[model samples]
Target: MAAKTEDLTELSNIISTNVKNYLSHVPTPPTLRPTPPVPVTDEVAAEAREQLLLACRRVISLVGGPIETVMGMSAAFHQTTAMKLAYDMKLAHNVPLDGSPIALGELAAKTGASEETIVRVMRALTLQDVFVETAPGYFAHTSGSAVIGIPGIEALIGHWTDESFASAPHISDALRENNFQPPEDSRKLAFNRAFDTNKNFFEYAYTEDKPMGARFSQAMTAAGTARGPYNLVAVYEPLRAAPKGTTLVDIGGGIGHVAIAAAQKFPNLNCVVQDIGMVVSEGRDGLPEELKDRVEFQENDFFKGQPIGGPGVYYYLRHILHDHPDPWVSLSRPISWEKGDSLGGILSHIASVMDSSSRILIDEDIMNEHMGPEGNKMTITLDFQMLVMCNGKERTEAQWAALLKSADERLVIEKVWRAKRNDSGIIEARLA
Candidate 1:
């Protein structure tokens, strides 16, 4: 035990040193950094961030004694609770924009939350470095609090706090009821169980509350923005390689963000954004003035036969496949996939319709081989989140290769394009 304590203390010192080293180079909080922060796209900054993340994980691993460790695990719910309260109350919005500290009473009055309650919640969040008490009974924005105010970020937080937080606790029961198999039915997953509904997550989000659905799309955009160097297009080689007039189909692309970005960047490329009727209509109506001639919207159920198919057409699926099990891709033809299945099925069907030179680009998290304490946080968190909500999963490179092979014997992995700053990899497959 003495040796263990000494090792932990040494690890703690290493963490402190690394953190100081990082701050020396990047003096400002990421939120306050210039629009398109240098650190976000810089290779050196990314490497430093990775090292800090690893050290933090090492520290996290040494957190408490047996009883304290168990209690700490149980207390994980507290962070979610505090985040939800602050977001719902718009407490972050109440903070001074210029970074000046505000008295606790003044902030409470601005947000209309009880001052005492606000104090408790804000103080709890401060423990996470979300907000800082600059002086007694006063609060100010830290990097975290400031960033939460960005459009779509608060929505992402809202989605997690309200929707995801409610469902996470039910994962154990969902598994037990499903015979310990990762469920294949979206309607039977923990999200449905928590909501006491048979509808899938998207159906509930879209049909139940239009605003919520819009927020989800916005949240996705925010996520893309946060990825910096890993933004969908930057990691896709095929898009860069495309000649003028290349028709790119964005399957299940919401609001055509990726397509719009591509169209704006590569003037010669024509994009077809496909999705359900509602989303396509929105994308079509909101199509930026400049992209009007270059990008078009189409309502096509991906589960059904891909409507636009020809030789040389590029198909892009960003953050789509992991939502369901492997079997749904092929079944998309016979029936709508209220439940999910593998990418192999859809890949096979698409491959059947493709011209010999056509390629498919899959943008998603490629789980690392060794996921220890310092594993990629987004990938690790989302893997379990997928299991609970849609019975889906994140795949590794080997798994991606296998899935593509199983989808079409003629399909071969062309290449994998990865960004220096993000966890996602773009897997390219082409007909052999």
Candidate 2:
């Protein structure tokens, strides 16, 4: 026990030192590091650093080692039966976003599943705190589940639960199958064998009346409507404040959350939300009676073409590019080398309409293999889901830059910003 404690302490110290080094190089925000009336004394600054390091050490000790935690998560990923049950219960219960207590029988009824099945599933989820049982057979939601409840969460979950994602259930298969890339026919074969159908997973879900499809739509709306409204406003604030007559086009915007947020933030700025007809119709129904006139939802399939011609402040593709692999390249190529025309085509379309001043902001994870075990593992997991569902793949910074560079000769990346709410990153590109 003493030895264990010493090991934890040393690990904590290492984490603290690394954190301090990282923070030291970043320019402190003016609000966070306001100009002091008097110069900061060395002794005071040193003491502050010590306090910060101690706090970091405490956090590290509490969380345990990064490697250990990652290994544990990898192990958990291998154990999917538990996750699936938790997902089912959460969907059935109508658990509040804030996570109030719920009854299992009630959830079972709502989901149209048997009580025994629900109970068994809940047992597994409760173990992981995906759903917390306040009492035996009674559960409550958590922040983790609440986030998962957001509209897009269902799509993500549905994609994962599909047989395509399940065929190679072992993590070793994921790692060993050259990061889970198979030839196109072979990939299709795996999926068909799993589902006993040739149809893609999404199409299959749509046909089978999987609640996950609608839930996915709602979850996407929840995530976008909640974080998107504010973040969209903030991201476009610079453009909003720019010279008048600025038109902003939201590309593949599901239900105009970003556009609505922008309109609310800057009433003077003109905005349009472009998406598929089905999504636009759904969004239109849910729009506040007042904002319908102000915000227009246009039927535009970004994969084919963007209808909005822009001399706009921003052409934003939020969480869209990550859903597609490089277009022209065959799916068999190493995901890193698979350069395609889909993303490039969209950017080219946007560029054709842009003036020299227009900008493009892509909100997605700019994966870094070296960031830490948490990010790397999560990204790879997500990548596998993408492969199974949509033939899409996540891109690293170099991959993103390469795509942007190839998309339009006039476009140049200005900044890559990280989100405070999640591990997502925004790659901001401007027409040079």
Candidate 3:
């Protein structure tokens, strides 16, 4: 126990030293640093951040020793609840934007929520360093709380706390009911169980619950933006000199941001951002005027076949494949997937249209072996969330290769356009 306690103490030291070290690096106001405020693209900074993440994970695991981690995680749901309440009540916005403190009463008045309730929610948030309490009743934003009220961010929170939150508690039930197997049917997942409807997540979002659907659309954009600005570093060279007159189809592309960015950089590439009707409409409306001729929005269902085929056509799928289980890439049973919505089904269409020169680019999180027992909890969290919301998953590199091959025997990955920043990137494939 002494050794365990010492380890925890060391993590606390890491925490204390980390703050001092990071702040020491930051230049004081009125004088900017020579280096970028955040060296997002720098390899050295990424390594530093990753070490910090490992330390944080160690502390998290250590917390389980002091207190049962299950209980700790269970109790943490209140933080989510409080956050949901805070966003719905506009508590983050009610605080003065310029860093001025607001009293509890003022916050309550702005949100039309009771002061008693406001205090409870604020108390929950402050413990997580979301909002700070300077005096007895006064509050200000911390880094965590400051971004809560941003437009797409608010919707992301809402989408998570609403349906996703509601479904998470049912994961065990969702699994046990399916004989602890990877369920191929979307409607049989936790989200359907939570909502007491047979509709799958997308059906529930767009048809059964339009408001949730709208929030989901906004949340997706917010989710992407939060990940980082659209990265084309992976496809920069090939896209810059894209095969002549290629109408690059961005399957399931939302608002066509990636496609738009691609068109601007790649003169030879024309793009058609294909999605459902609503997403197509939104993309068309938001597309920049200068790039309108270069990029076009077309209503298309990804589950259906690819529309165009030629000598060297391009198909780009960003963050799309992982949202499904590959029926062809079996879990408990080989050739198990019967659902038409499987990754194999989707890839089959693209493969059918591919010639030797034609390319398919999958931009997704490809999980890899990392430094710790449990690597990158965000990826794990997403994997579970997919199980809860859509009966989907994240995949390893081997699994990705298997999935593509399962789609078509001749399909082969030519390269991985890996970014310096993270494990997620574009996998470029062509017919063998």
Candidate 4:
């Protein structure tokens, strides 16, 4: 056998060639929407983008200096912090959208921020390709900065900057105080420690202030925007396959997004969106007139017993489980688990009501088995966010399987449908 070797330069060259070739084959994306610059509409383009991005990252790491690399890692939070400040100051909104530039002093006056502060923050973002300095002292919106001014995206920025940022500092404290244990109660998590409150994030945001609750809802909508059409409904094939008039129970469904989507896609599939009393009421009112006949809203706490039960129905929970802490005990056979408290109790109740034909659909991000250098970054980041806010976590495939088995031995994993060009999956479970 011939001894073959590759140097860093050669590796970089190969990666660069691969990236260029991949990009060359794909159609060029527009600079802005309604013709979105993101190649999200095309599956092949999306996959190509993934490959190109990984290659580019590899090339950068292989060529970059160790000191500079470490410095960039250390200063990673600065970009987010500056972006947050930009959002806070409404810099994106103040900047001209028609390619004309706003002088630093004028922009500062509009935002009520100092000219010097505005210059520093704008310059920082400009370097990152967020905004652009067309002239020596004037700034204008780039494709990146323009989107943040939208109500939904701005709300998302506010939620992350104001709510999530507040909790970041307390994660270490919460971990240290609990002896590095995941706190059992959500109230004892990093968010509570940061604000010195007993209420959970949702409770604080929803009950304490109505406007904040509304913004949180908008923020969630905005957060999902990047995913485009690669949604839970698209991933869950059972909905399309089900017979007409099949009922889907969406438990803990906030504002009934999934149910609405399902009802719209599968006209014959009736949906019952269940959540807390307040959310249910809001959902009921917020539902479109066309969907009103197909989709209905109900008030029900999932921790309590199953509210509705029947054969051939699908109970859907999208992005719900990760907000809950790990199970404390098994639910197989019979156990002294209290109702209206934990997921085990809820699962047991659901199992008791489920027939062999019925299925429970969990649509969530199941973490990769081995989180490598090229692993999904959003899932990992969200896992920590869950940890800090609720002592919850994004579970791996094995963890999900184990959880289902532990919840109820009869609750077998029927299938896991992971979507192409997306990390989200639909895990369908049924009674054995």
Per-residue alpha-carbon lDDT of candidate 2 for residues 1-432, written as tens digits (9 for 90 to 100): 111343556656655664565456435511211122122223334344444454554455457777876676667654466556556555623764444666867777777777887677666665655657778777677544554554465555644554434654433443345655543322253444555665544445545545645655555665454433245655434755655556777787777777777777777667678876667787788777766666777887554455666454678788777665554221112221124332325677776667767788887766775543234345576676666555567888888878876776677888877654344667888878
lDDT of 3 by residue, 1-432 (tens): 122343767767766665455545544321111111223444544554565666776777676575677777778778789988887788878897666789888888888999999889988988888888989999987767777777888898888888989898888887897688967777777888899988778777777787888788898887776766565633346777666567788898878878887887777778989888877888898888898778998887666567878878888888777776676222212221235333436788888877898888888877875534436667777888888898778878777888888878888888888766666777888899
- Each prediction's RMSD over C-alphas, in Å, is 3.7, 9.2, 4.7, 3.9
Residue-level lDDT tens digits of model 1 in 1-432: 121333776776766776666666675645532133233455666666777677665566566556776787789899889999999999878897677899988997888889889988987899988888889999988777877788778778877888888998898998898688875566778888888877778777788767877888778767766676434567575567777899989988888988998888777789998888778888888888988888999887676567787878989898888876666542332222544443325676677788788988888898998756557888988998788777778988988888787777777888888767767888888988
Per-prediction TM-score: 0.89, 0.67, 0.87, 0.90
Output the better candidate (1/3) by lDDT.
Answer: 1
Identify the leading candidate in terms of TM-score: 4
Between candidates 2 and 3, the TM-score winner:
3
Poorest 10 consecutive residues by lDDT, candidate 4: 329-338
By lDDT, the candidates rank as 1, 4, 3, 2
Please list the C-alpha lDDT of all candidates, in the order they appear. 0.77, 0.59, 0.75, 0.76
Instruction: Tell me the tens digit of each residue's lDDT in model 4 across 138-181.
Output: 88777888878888888988877887888987898888887988
